[model samples]
Target: MYLLILGLLMALLKFLEFGFLAEVSWWWVLVPFGLAALWWVWADSSGYTKRKAAEKIEQKKRDRIEKHRESLGLHKRRH
Candidate 1:
């Protein structure tokens, strides 16, 4: 699916005969720019990073619980 759109873009660029391709000599710029834009969107708006942060907080709570139990000498406390 993505490949089709890419092919069409390249074909259009060729058809238009945009001379920027030759003067800029940075034909690969489009790929990196697209990737950076994607990364920014996904990293900023997605829940993946939020979930990871939540997991870290849960882990810290567990660690604090273990420390509290050790301090109170209740390592073998039953639930």
Candidate 2:
């Protein structure tokens, strides 16, 4: 995400001929975008994305269950 944002900022700067970015090649300005793409491919193939998504879903489920229990006045007792 950061890489993409940075790349976009650089691209915009280059397009507007601002600062030193004005002299930079378009290919250089686009490097961050390429890196971001590679990172996404690696993360997806390594299951990192799926694991994070699964964890998020599990957390939501737990939160919903807790809310339901509270609504029913069914709280867990501390030992």
How displaced is residue 24 in candidate 2, in Å? Answer: 1.7
Candidate 2, poorest ten consecutive residues by summed lDDT: 69-78
Worst 10 residues of 1 by lDDT: 20-29
Q: Top model by TM-score, which number?
A: 2
Q: What is the lDDT of residue 32 in candidate 2?
A: 99
Point to the candidate with the largest lDDT: 2
* Clash-forming residue pairs, model 2: none
List, residue by residue over 1-79, the lDDT tens digit for candidate 2. Answer: 9999999999999999999999989999999999999999999999999999999999999999999998998979689
Clashing pairs in 1: none
Error (Å) of candidate 1 at residue 29 is 8.4
Model 1 per-residue lDDT tens digits across residues 1-79: 3644674565466557665543443455256457656766786698777888999999999999999999999888678
